[model samples]
Target chain A: MSFLKYRLRMDKNVHLIMKILTVFSIVTILAILLGLLYKAYPILKTHSLTNLLLSKDWFPQKELFGLFPFISSTFQVTGLAMFIAVPFCLLASIYLSEYASKSITRLVLPLIDILAGIPSVIFGIWGIILIVPFIRDYVAPFFGKVSSGYSILTGGIVLAVMLIPVMVNILLEVFNTVSRGYKEASLALGATKWQCIKHVLLIKSAPGIISAIALSLSRAFGETLAVLMVVGNVTKSPKSILDPAQPLPALIANNYGEMMSVDLYDSALLLASLVLFIIVLFFNIIARVILRRLEKNNH
Target chain B: MKFKAKFIEERIFKILMITSTSIILLSLGAILGSILYKGLPSLSWEMISQTPKGGFYLGKSGGILNAILGSFYIAFGATAIALLVSLPVALYINIYRKKFSKYSNLVRLCLDVLWGVPSIVYGALGFSVMLYIGLKTSLLAGIIIVGILIIPVMIRAMDEVIKTIPKGLVEASLALGSTKTETAFKIVVKQALPGIITAILLSFGRAIGDAASVMYTTGFTDNIPKSLLSQAATLPLAIMNLVSSPIVEVQNKAYASALILTFIILFLSIISRLLSIKYTKNKSH
Candidate 1:
C-alpha cells in the first residue's frame, strides 16, 4: 500500500512539471502578441485609427503615414489569388479525393508535400523568370495594355501558386472525410457521380471548405517574400490588375531599415505588423472554432 | 434526352477535374525545371566553397559559402531550441492530460493560432523583442525568433504522431507498475521516435528556408559568422539580394543559390520519407 502511494506521488510530480511547461508555452504566445501591441502603442496613440487606415498619403518624412494604399493592395492581391485558387483547388481536390486511383493518389500527395515545402524565395525567383516576363510581354499585350510585369497581376498569380498546395491539402482532407458509404448512398439512389458530388459531398463538406479558406486566406494575407519580389512596390493603390501596388508586408520589409531614421517609423512598422497579427489571429480563431465544432459533430 | 444530359454533365465535370489537376502537376514540373535549367550553368565549385569577394554582385568573383554556413548555424541552433520546448509540450499534452480536456484543447488552439501567424509577423515580433532586450541583429537573435516560429510546427507534428500510439501498449506499461512518465518516455517516445525525427527534419528545413523572420533579426554579412553575436547571412536573403542585380552573372548566381537551397530541402524531405517508411515497416514486424 505504501509503495503504491509513493508511485502515485511520483506520477503526480511528473504531471505537475509537465503542466508548468505547457502553461509556459501558452504564456509565451500571449506575450508575443502583447509585446507587438506594446511596441506599436506610440503610433496608435499619435495617429487616429481612421486616419492611419484610410488616408492615402504615406510620406514618412513629414510624419504623414497613411496605410490605405498598402491595405488596398493587400486586399486586391489576396482577393485575386483566392479567386484563382478556389476553383483550381476545388477541381483538383475533387479529382484526387473522388476519381483518382490509389496509386495516383499516393504519387500526388508527396508531390503536394514537396510543393508546400518549397521556399518562398525560390518561388520569387521563379516569378522573376517566368511570371513577370510572361505578364509583361504576352499577357498584357494580349489585353492591349502595357505593364512592367511587376504588377498586382504578377503578385496575384505568384501568390495563387504558393497558396495552391496548402489549400488543396486541406480541401482534399476535407473531401476525404466524407465516407465511402455516404458517397455510395447518393450514387445508389440513382444519382450520377457528378450529381452525388455536387449535391451531397459538396454540401456535406461546406463547413470544412469554409475553414480551409479561412486558414489559407490568413496564409495568403501574410505571405511576404514572393509577393514582395514580384509585386511592384508602388505606394499607390492599383487601379487595375496590371497596375503596380505595395502590400503591407512588402511595405514593412522594404522600408523598415531605411525609414528607421524617420521619426515614429519603428512605431509605424510595428503598427502594420500589429494589424496583420490581429487579422491573422481573428481568422485562425474562426478556423479553430469551426474545426472544433466539425470534430464534435463527427463524433 | 434528360438521361443523356445527365451523362454529359458527369463527363464534362470529370474532364474539368482532370484538366485542373494536370495543370497543378505541370506547374510543379515547370518550377523545378526552371530552377534546374537556369541554375546549373552558373553553379561552380568555387561558389560552394568560397565566400564572396568585393564586387560579387557586380558580376565579380565569389561564392555563397557565407550564407550557406550561416544558414546551417542558425537552422541547427533554432531547431535545437525549438525541440527542447516542443518535445515537453507534446508529451505533456498527450501523456499528462485527458485527450479532450479543456486545457489540452486550449493549448491546441494556441498552437493552431501560432501556426497561422505569418513568419513576417514573427519577424516583426522578433525585431521588437530584440530591441526590448537591447540585443543587436545577430545570429543569436535570428535563432531565437526562428526557434519560436518553428515550435508550433514541431509540436503539432509530434502531437499527431504521438496520438496514434495504441492505447493498449500504454495501458500495458502502466499495468506493469511503470509510472506514467516512465511509460511516456520509455514506450510512447520510442514508438514515436521516427515521427519525432521526421518532425525535427521538417522543421529544420522550414527554419533554414525561412527568409522573413531572419531578415530583420540577423543582420546580413559577407563573411561566415565568427560567433553568436556576429551578423550572419542566409541563402534566402542572399537570393533576394542577388536577384535585384542588373548583372546577368549575379542573377544567375541567385538561381544557383536557389538550386542549392532546393536541393537541401529535397534531401531532408527524402530522408524523412525514408525514415518513416523504414520505421513503420519495422513496427508491423
Candidate 2:
C-alpha cells in the first residue's frame, strides 16, 4: 500500500513538472514577441504609420526619416539577386533531380550543402578582395565614371551567390517530393523526360518553387554582412548597378553606432527593422498560404 | 521522325541543364580558389598561434590564437545555454500534446519571426540589454545574443525530432508502468539522440559562422578572455576587422581567417549531413 502511494506521488510530481515546462515554452514564445515589440516601441510612439511607410529620405543624421530609399535599394538588390539565382537554381534542381547519376548527385548535393554552410562574411571577404576590383576596373569603366570601389552591383552579385545554395536546396527538396508516378506516367505517354519535367513536375511543384523563391528573396532583403561589406553605404538613390546605394539592413548596421542623437537613431533603426519584419512576415504568410493551397489541391 | 525530333530535343535540354548546374559548381570553385590564392601564403603556424597586435602594415606581428579560442568558447557556451532552455520546452510541448499543442503553432510562428529578424537587430537589442544590465561588450553579451539566435533554430529542429519519435513506443513504455518522464527520457529522446545531435551541430555551425550579431555585442578585443566577462574577438569578427583596415597584409590575413572559418563551417556541415543520413538509414532498418 505504501509503495502504491509513493508511485502515485511520483506520478503527480511528474505531471506538475511537465505542466511547468509547457508554461516555460509558452513563456519563451512570449518573450520573443515582447522583444520584437520592445524593438518596435520607438516607431509606435513617434511616427505616424503612413508617413513612416511612404517617406523617401533615410538620413538619420539630419533627422530626415523616410524608408523609401532603403526599401527601393532592398527591392533592387533582391530583384537582381532573384533574377540571377532563380534560373540557375531551377536548372540545377532539374538536373540534380532528373538527370544526374546517383553517384554524382551524392557528391554534388553535399558540395552545395557545404556552399550553404560557407559564412556570409567569407562571401563578403571574397567580394571585397576579388569582385570589387573587377567591378571597379572593368564593369564600372564600361558603365562610366565610378568613384567608390564598392557598388550596388558588387553587393547584388555577392547576395546572389550567397542565396544560390538556399535556393537550390529548397527547390531540390520540392522536386524530390514530386511523385515519381507522375514522371513515369508522363514518360509512358511518350513524353520525353525533359518534357515531363517541364510540364508535369515543374508545374505541379510551382507553388513550392514560388515559396522557395520568396524565401530566398526575403533572405536577400535581410542579408546584412555581405551587403554591408560591399555596398558603398551611399544614401542616395542608385542610378545604376554601378552606383553605390544603401539597403535597409546595411543602413541600420552601419549607422547604429555612429548616430549621435539617440532618439533619431533608435527611431530610424526601429523603422528599418519594422519594414524588414513586415517583408519577412508577409513572405511567411504567403508561403504558408501556398503550402495550404497545395495541401488542399492534393487532397 | 517524331522520335528523332524528341531525342534531339531531349539532348538539347540535358545539355542546358548540365551547363547550368556546372555554372553553379564553377562559381563555388572560383570562390574557393580565389580565397585560397589570396589567403594561403599568409597562413602560418605562428600566425595561428600568436595574438593580433597593431595594424596590418606592421607585418606578421600577431596571430589569430585568441580569436579562434574565443570563437569556440562563445559558440559552445551559447549552444549549451540554448539546448538547456529549448529541450525541456520541446519535450513539454511534445509529451502533453492536447494541452500544449495549440500553443505549438504560435511557438513556431515566433521562431520563424526570430529567425527572420536580421542579425544586426539582435546585436542592437543585445547591446541595449547588456548596457542596461551593466555587462557591456562582455562575452556574456555575445553568448546571450548568440543564444537567442540559436534558440529558434534549435527549438524548431528539436520539436521536429521529438514529434518523429513513434507514439506507439511511448505508449508501450507508459503501458509498462513507466511514468511520463521515463517514457520521454528513456523511450522518446533516447531514440531521437542522433537527431538531437544533428540539431546541436546545426546550431553550432550557425553560431560559429555568425559575425554581424556578435560584432557590436561582443566588442572585439585581441586579448584572450580570462573569464566570461572579458571582451574578446571571434574569428569572423577578426576577419571583418582585417578586411576593413586599409593595409594589404592585414587584408591577406583577413582572407586567411575567412578561409579557416569557411573550412570549419564546411567540415561541421558535412558531418551534420552525414549524421542526418545515418539517422534516416537507421530508422529504415
Candidate 3:
C-alpha cells in the first residue's frame, strides 16, 4: 500500500514537470514577440507606417529612419534567388519521385542532406573567395563595367545555392506524396512517362510546391552573414542587380555595433528586425497551412 | 518521317531531367571542391590548439584554440538545455495526450513554423531581449537563444522517433497494468532511445554551426568564456571574421576553421546515421 502511494506521488510530480516544460515553449514564443514589439515602441508610436516602410532616406547619423530600401532589397534578393532555383528544384523533384531507382534515390538523398547541413558561415566563406571572384571576373563584366564583386547578383546567387537543397527536399516530399493511381491512370491512357508526370503529378502537386517555395523564400529573406559578406552592405537603394544594396538582416548585423552612437538608431533597427520577424513568421504560417492541406489530400 | 510526339517529348524531358539533377550535384561539388582546395593547405596542429596572439587577423600568430573550445562549450550547454525542454514536451505530446489530438497537432504545427524560421531572425530577437534586460552579449545569452532556436528541431525529431514506436507495444504495456508515467518513461522512451540520441546529435550540430544568431548575442573574445556571462568566440564567427579580413594568412586560417567545422558536422551526421540504423534494429524486436 505504501509503495502504491509513493508511485502515485512520483507520477504526479513528473506530470506537473512535463506540463510546465510544454507550456514554457509557448511562453518563449510570446516572449520573443513582445520583446521585439517593446523595443520597436518608439518608432511605432512616432512615425507614420508609410514613412517608416516606404521612405528612401536611411541616414542614421542625422536621425532620419526610412526602411524602404532594406525592405525592397530583401524582397528583390529573395525573388531573384527563388527564380533561379525553382525550375531546377521542380525538375529535380520530379526526377527524384518518378524516375530515380532506389539505389540512386538512396545515394542522392543523403548527399542533399549533407549539402543542407553545411553551415551558413561556410557558405559565407565560399562566397568571399569563390563566388565573389567568379562574379567580379566573369559574370559582372557581362552586365557592364562593375568594379567591386559585391552586389545584389552576388547575394542572389549565393542565396540560391544555399536554398536549393531546402526547396528540393520539401518539393520532393510533396511530389512523392502525389497519388500513384493518378500516374498509373495517365500512363494507361497512352500518356508517356514524362507526360504522366507533367500533366498529372505536377499539376496536382502545385500547391505543395508553392508552399515549398514559400518556405525557401522565408529563408532567403532572412539570410544574413553570407549576404552581408557579398552584398557590400550599402545603405542606398540598388539601381540594378550590379549595384550593392543592404537588406534588413544585413543592415542590422552590420550596424548594431554603431547603432547606439546615433539617436533613434537603436529603436529603428530593432523596429526593422521586428518587421522582419513578423514577415517571416507570417510566411512560415502560410506555408504550414498549405502543407497541412496537402497532407490532408494525401490521406 | 513523322515522329511520335509523345516519344519525342519523353526523350527531351529525359535530357532535361538529367541536366537538372546534375545541377544539384554540380553545385555541391563546386562548394566542397573549392572549400577543401583552399582549406586543406592551411590546416595545422598549432591552428587547432593555440589562441590568437596580437594581430591574429593579420595571420601573424596564435591559433583558433579559444574559438574551438568556446564553440564546444556553447553548443554543449545549449544542447543540454534544449534536451531538458524538448524531451518532456515531446513525451507529453506523444504519451500524455491522445495521439494526434487537436492539441498535439497544434503544437506540431507551431513547431513546423518555428522550424522554417531563419537563424538571423532568432539573432534579432536575442539582441532585442538582451537590451531589454540590460545584458551584454555573453555566453549565457548565446546559449539561451540557441537553446530556444533548436527546441523545435529537437522536439519534432524526438516526437517522430517516439511516434514510430509500435502501438501494439504500448498497448501491451498498458494491458500489463503499468502506470502511464512509468510506461512512458521506462518503456516508450526506452524504445525510442536510439532516436533520442540522433535528435541530440542533430541539434548539437545545428547549435555549433549557426553563426548569425550568435553574431550579436555572443560577442567574440580572444579568450575562452570563464563564466556564462563572459563573451566567447565561435568557429563559424571566427571563419566569418577571418575571411572578411584583408590579410591573406588569416583567409587561409578561415578555411582551416571551416574544415574543422565541416569535420564536426560530418561526424555528427555519421553518428546519427548509425544510431538511426540501430533504431530500426530495435523496432524489429
> Best-fitting candidate, measured by lDDT?
1
Each prediction's DockQ against the real complex = 0.71, 0.54, 0.70
| Count of clashing residue pairs in every prediction | 0, 1, 0
lDDT of 2 by residue, A38-153 (tens): 76677667777667667886656566687777788888878888888888889888899888999999889888877887888988988887889999998877768764669888
| Every candidate's TM-score, chain A alone | 0.94, 0.87, 0.96
User: What interface RMSD do all candidates show, one decimal each?
Assistant: 1.6, 2.8, 1.4
Ranking by lDDT: 1, 3, 2
Off by over 4 Å in 1: A1-14, B1-3
**Alpha-carbon local distance difference test for all models:** 0.90, 0.79, 0.86
Arranged by DockQ, best first: 1, 3, 2
Q: Which stretches of candidate 3 lie above 4 Å from their native place? A: B281-285
RMSD in Å for model 1: 1.9
Comparing 1 with 2 on DockQ, the higher-scoring candidate is 1
Residue A8 lDDT in candidate 2: 69
Question: What TM-score would candidate 1 get against the native?
Answer: 0.97
Q: Once superposed on the true structure, which residue ranges of model 2 sit more than 4 Å away at CA?
A: A1-47, A144-149, A260-262, A292-299, B1-8, B55-60, B98-106, B277-285
